[model samples]
Target: MIGEPMPDPRRSIIDNLNQQLDAFFGAGKSVQVIPSGVSADAPFFGTNSHQLKLRAERDKLAPAVRAEAAKGVVASVAAKNLRMHVKRVTLIAQENGFRFADNP
Candidate 1:
């Protein structure tokens, strides 16, 4: 087992993000419906155990690998934000009587 190669840490984070987004927004639907009069101003970023583990393990990697890992984290966060924004925009547009082409 000692000879087994470990997986890239960034891939795990990306997978986790994708799973969470799918669970929230559903597969293939970038946007979700929010009931009338509900506000959507929740913040996205949070320091959690997963991040702490990444930070700890990151210190052990080479500088070049660490840099790449940081980029992965940034990209993952951006993708997540984009997904949430789609949901928010859809909810707002719906409240204003605009229907999505595919949804309507």
Candidate 2:
């Protein structure tokens, strides 16, 4: 495996996004991550129609909803570091406007 090609980081991020969304929204929800390169056409991470709906619903709730969502996202990414070569992970909670303590 010395000369094997490294996995694409974008693909890894997309896969992580899908798994995290499923865990947050339950098994049957449709969630996908579309990766576009470092170009202007790249879409924001969670701006799909289904995600828009979920965000709208969450927005209607108390401020804690946003914090919880951020925490979940950060936790999901951090978990991936266990099996993958994650260089860094950062979690920013919008409610308190503070970042999580980095473990690395």
Candidate 3:
């Protein structure tokens, strides 16, 4: 496993959506995807018998979302076009689940 690259985090749906909301409205404006009408572990079951919800964070999420990117070291790549980025992670996840869904 030496020299193997670590998985990119920005490619995550939730992270992208959060960044989008933040880019649109500024930090703390980001939202989180929570399990709705379903247990927290429902996604592990591979069942469509659950629901997901997007909720705005009541506290500051800037640190959580921007820290890795803002760090001035080699880890700073996240701050770049990575410049941009989930979710509405559930909605996107659903789209991944049901690919035929319309974007609009």
| Best by the TM-score measure | 1
TM-score of each: 0.26, 0.25, 0.18
Q: lDDT at 51 for candidate 3?
A: 30
Query: Per-residue CA lDDT of candidate 3, range 23-77, in tens?
Result: 8777445556866676564465443443322223312333443443234322223
Model 1 Cα lDDT, one tens digit per residue, 7-51: 899999999999998887775567768996675574335556776
List of clashing residue pairs for candidate 3:
13-86, 14-86, 15-86, 16-85, 16-86, 17-86, 17-87, 18-86, 80-83, 81-84
Question: Candidate 2, 101: how far from true, in Å?
Answer: 59
Q: State which candidate, 1 or 2, has the greater lDDT.
A: 2
Q: Tens digit of lDDT per residue, candidate 2, span 79-103? A: 3633322222222233334453344
Top candidate on lDDT is 2
On a 0 to 1 TM-score scale, where does candidate 3 land against the true structure?
0.18
Residue 99 CA displacement from its true place in model 2, Å: 48
Q: Which portions of model 3 show Cα errors greater than 4 Å?
A: 1-3, 8-11, 27-104
lDDT of 2: 0.52
